[model samples]
Target: MTTASWLAIAMATIVSAALAQEGQTQSEEIEELEEIVVSASRIELKASEVGSAVTVITAEEIERRGDRYVSDILRDVPGLAVNRTGSFGAFTQIRIRGAEANQTLVVIDGVEVNNPAAGSEFDFGSLLVDNIERIEVLRGSQSALWGSDAIGGVINIITKKGQKGFRGFASASAGSFATHDLNAGFSGGGERYRFAFDASRFSTNGISHADEDDGNPENDGHTISQGNVSFGVTPIENLDIDFTGRYTRSFLETDGSIFNVSSLTDLDNDATVYQRYGRANVAYDLFGGAWSHRASVAVSDVDSKNRSNNATSFTSEGDKLKLDYETTYRFETESIPDAEHAATLLLEHEKDTIQTSSMANEVDIKTNSIAGEYNLSLFDDLHLSLSGRFDDSDNFEDEMTYRVTAAYNLRETGTRFHSSYGTGVKNPSLTELFGFTGTFVGNPDLEPEKSKSWDFGVEQGFFEDRLVVDLTYFNSRVTNLITGSGNTAVNLSGTSPAQGIEVSADAEVLDNLNLIASYTYTNAETADGTEQVRRPRHIASLNVNYRFLEDRANVNLGIDYNGDQKDTRFSPTFARSIVGLDSYTLVNVNATYDIHENVQLFARGENLLNEDYEEVFGYGTPGVSGFAGVRVDF
Candidate 1:
């Protein structure tokens, strides 16, 4: 079937369901409007009170879907696109609202994880779902709250913390491609102290990175091991201390590239990556919890090595250190009766360093910033937020960014109107500013990229909130986009504009069944009016969840559709040219059954339709695959 036909059918199903249950209400509870969002603002705010486009994926939903990788879960998010170059452990990139991959900032437990040596982009390839409690995605320009590299948005991943009592879990799974996964975690806590630890190991004899149909039959394999620890202690009544640390190591077999061509048939090519992250935080409250102070220090280090013919060919190391201090005060005044106000001030400093075998000298960059935010709530129905930041960099000119947002709720009509306007700035990455491999020379004179974005959306709830739908329109214009000219990097004089519409719906169709659907229409182009490569014009997804057998058994079905898009293909015999990639659909299903109070069994099937497709031009994708696992809790 055609892409249009699939989209039409999906839309028809959603519309028909809504109409059929127009006046009917379910007894089961729907998602609460009071859900708190921590990433949207300096202070935690309810989802209904935040003006930004936000999506939250909870651990419960992750378990139901049985997704081992975080990237798989993000594919269903609105206004986002995920592309993987090859098998599970290959390079993965995520673009938000047609923005570049490096434009999005990723934060894990308040620590920035984007690699400074690799264009400041966070690769999602090795990010597993272990120990993650929730993920909050805040869309649009967020430079006012975060610093540089947030032009597209921010993704905050919060891991599980210790609970009141002792708890632990263990799981094991074996699947197709000779894959195996093992995970275990434990947490324990009391009133004044808490701690948690988790570990995981995964391995797979994967498919060929290069398309096997091209006479490349060699299989590539990958393996990863990761560990995490979180600890917190309250030494006094008003003071708290917390610490978190994580380490990951991964090895991946890969196909080599010949000149401009990628994914060539090769036998001895592989890459190894090591990552370490640590953070320490202190918090204090005064004046009966109305005034708060926080101080934190974080560090991130990454080392990568690539080998050819069993010999090390290239290596790079990047490190970042950050320090932050913040204070917030909350008050209510008689001048504005029944209104609440919060003001926050923050000071931050960051240093980045990179060393590569190809560079003669180690490079370093430093930045200092001060930011402030003001939040207002009126009559429990209206919310407003304003924020601004000033950043001073040693290698670039000073920059100022600001954002304004408003959200109004109509209780009688069960409707909400929200809007935001923001300006963002992104400094050039280390590699873009310094030469690499003696081939791509850096441009020290490159200016920072700047952008202005705005979005408006309305959300409507029906049948006592059993069904909810949201529609949003967003537009952004970016200037000073850096591009490669000959062997040196240069900033473009023209502006690139991206505009899109996002639609999403959630409904409780039956007592034990729920449905979620989303569709996006994006028009993203370069300065010369060419479509952005790898960004599909249309994307849609549908997921259905059901519980049965006294709520002891659960099943989930998901469908994803990616519309045709353009991609750049490099060939040894021909010049690099734009090529069209065919559209494709994927179907996945998973089921879980609780046989005992502390034990459960689960199974998952991916690519059930056995579709043949490629996310990146020459890279291969997995076909039909299945897995079964058993989990135990104590």
Candidate 2:
């Protein structure tokens, strides 16, 4: 109590223990910078070095979850599931865990756009959102590096190349029943030379039901027209070139959704569709050596019609093609000395073509591929991933897939774990190998539906970095899984496997409030025991947000829950056209206000607690809907 006040309390206890050990080494360096990840092992490894389970949706959370297709921005991302039927963008479906929709594998800006005559799957309502800037979801089973629907995972959509300047904007919206008009374009000399153009004309007199004004059931009324163009060039400065074009046209009406989707006892129906997509790219980067290169190409087309109400009418068409190439090599030494090493190698080639035209029937098909991958890390938080692929088809022959991943982190309790195994192949669709109704029969010695999946996960985080958590568990097996007997639509009967569990979370919890959550569980049956129908054995999501002005104003809210399913073709020959779906919850709200400095004002509402579900099965959605817009920046 007196040697000069105990030397000033021992210099304040050694400066509070060196500021709590430099704040825990900057909170373990921001949790190793949020476990920096790269779409699950396509090289650029990290997500704890990839075992599996990778989810990222940037572009400012897809503009605050406003949704504009990328499968409605992955319906709140968490084991994913999106099923919408009719709303201008009718019949949109994206299934992850229960694995359908061709087992899911979509990539844009990195090519491989799926839908090769409906084999790999990609119609995410004709993908559009002006110009996607980020998306990376690598759930479980990536077919060893993306070879055929990855068996319920792998989606990459990255777009936005106009480095800095030469702005563009235009948007419009009308409510009560949907109406949209938009325009956009970009002009050269910014990143050397760049160009982009977009167009839209949406329509809807939709959603009001309460059955009968044909369009066939649930809400009714619709129309759509869309267009897109993208171009880029940097001729010098490391050379780069890009191109994109797209189109869509639609019109529909189906009796208030077939009398709320299969009840109005005697309602009527009608439909339409047309889609097209094209893309190209070339890139080269060689900063003082170690090699770098990339190349790409893609094309897709679809045509459709189905005018019925008993008057009868039908038509269909399809086409697709894809190719890609890559090369990367980077090396830095001292691997065993002072730890630091980076290495990577990747190679690929792909192709596809499919055709179908039917007033009843017509078919054509093709798919070919070859691939390879390699990765390594030695300080970027320990990582290793490898991949291999080979596929050949003209009716199947030659198949193989390989994968490996390892990640480790404890760098003082940032806590992480990873595991993965993949192999998938799903081929057969031209309406299941050349289709035709009123006497179902189509099968050209069908054989294709091999699958194997795996996943293991763990994640944790805390404050100096706004809480985050991730938990995962997954299992899969397909083994020639396709079913049909008595009329054969591409015969296949036996294997059907599925099992799952998932939980995801995110929290900034107030700097401006942020919270996101997810939960999913599934067990798909079918050993002829049926129960793979509308796939829902539980699903949930919640999101909340608030951020004012300086952050450029914001307000957001969302909630979705689903459960209740059964109707695997309800027997007795489509049992009066199977129907049974119930259990739903939906609510959404949004607002953004900048209103100045470049202008911004937004408003949104979807279902806003209007409930009354149905993702298909008697159709019903769109109860309180809304839209308001304004966005300008130059």
Candidate 3:
């Protein structure tokens, strides 16, 4: 049967189930749909009120999974694909809805951290899951609200904040491959002031970047040290000030290319990377919180150096500064009783600079943008939002983008219908326009890539809200796609089309057991009807969490499956050809026990089945490995 047929059947089944349970009241003990989401709009709103697809990963879930890297935690999200070049600390990338890696925007505490020197892409290799309170993954075209580099989606990483009282935590862990991880943090707050601090270090003697089975014997090691600080103060009534700062330094052992053809050989190569990010904000409220104003500034800096045979061969530095001001007004009218409305206006300016060893002069790009948003909620049943943005850039043509979203709830039937439509634009990156030595040639005439996307979904609840299911269909078309042609970056004349389906379910099977599962089917193709590289046709995951031993001990089991995909291969015999990668499945298990009220012990096993798999061609993956850790809270 065709994909359409499958979708039709699934929709019919869900609708029928919803109708069967119409007019039923939810049990009081069942969970409610009151989760607050901030990334979907300028202001906070309930998840059910947002029309776009969003997934929230909480700190509790991160702890239960025992994943050291944030990328590992995102593998289970629908419509997302994570590829790690090798083992831990290797280069990692994520694709959303078959979009290019550089199209996804990453925000860390209101700071854009994309590397301007590397084609505006954010490498997830060095992003650890330390001191993170929650992560909101907003999928789809979001340029209308977030400006550039948001053609695919947006990821907002929010760190933990200070609480009413003083608290602190420390953890130590050791695992396979001679790995060690240590972290500590403290947070405190009062009526007028709050502060938090965190520090961590991780080191591992990882396997070879090239596949060991291919005669690579050398071991590549990686190390990282990171620190974070946050402070907030309320000097007077209705006025607030906040600040955040983070720094990360990392070292990785890489592999060199063989005869300038393949990077599948074990050669002595290394890289050092440093990242610094800071943000400050001031906000005030007027007219009893009906009107609010905010101003903020953020900065990000990245420096990287690569060495070959103990000699520095390449170095690059990039920095970005952003300034933003926003005002929002909320009101309700007697004509529309119980209806809520909000209007927001935003102004932003951004500047990016890149300096590399290969270039004699530093390069800079600047952009100024204005955006507006309006939200309406009718009796808490019908929600609607409209947003628009205009951007003027020094390097690219002026662009305008817009987005519309709607969400409707049938509370009597426990059903919701959500839909969104948006347009996006991505400017040419510095590297693509100016080129990098020995890699890509300059293409100053390259045009900006543009896209239009839309999605519709239905969410249904059953068994007094004990089980919930969501299904969505998304489609997108891109024009002037930036690609490499014989080492020269150029824009394609034809349009590339992509479509996909995402299905996810969360169920409370028992009082102590919970299950989550998701499946995605994607059909991404180039203009010539060829499948896009690195995008799998099918992906699925399942996870189960159970609590036992008087709620003091917990266990989690996770399984992930990646379907066959195509990748490009370069060999001495052939210039380049498409190669097929076999499908693989991995199983992971984690368990935690509370030794005391303020202490816990945990252990996790990765790749328990020992299935040999490679996310990227010519890269090696870790075998079965186990880790044990202890955490103390005071």
Per-residue lDDT over 532-559 for candidate 1, one digit per residue giving the tens place of the 0 to 100 score: 8988988888888999999999999988
Candidate 3, residue 14: the lDDT equals: 51
TM-score rank order? 1, 3, 2
Clashing pairs in 3: none
State residue 36's C-alpha deviation in candidate 1, in Å. 0.6
The clash count for each model shown is 0, 21, 0
Q: Highest TM-score among the candidates is held by which one?
A: 1
Q: Mark the 10 consecutive residues where model 2 has the least summed lDDT.
A: 257-266
- C-alpha TM-score for every candidate: 0.97, 0.31, 0.95
Residue 323 Cα positional deviation in candidate 1, in Å, after optimal superposition: 0.4
Please report the TM-score between candidate 3 and the true structure. 0.95
- The residue-by-residue lDDT of candidate 2 on 1-634, one tens digit each, is 3222332344334434544455555544333454455567645654556767778777887777675556765877777777775454556778888878777877766656566555446767545666566788887667656676677887887766554556766666577675564645554347477776667776766763322233334456666677767777887887788887777777666543222343433235656777777778787879754567877777777676776665656555566666767676766666354343344444444445444444233455565666666666666676666777777766778788887767666657767777777777777665566654545566767777777888777786544435556778888877667656666644346667777778776765545767777777778766565668767777777777789768888988877676676543233234434446776767778788886878887888887766656676544456677888887766
User: Candidate 3: misplaced stretches above 4 Å?
Assistant: 1-28, 31-33, 260-263
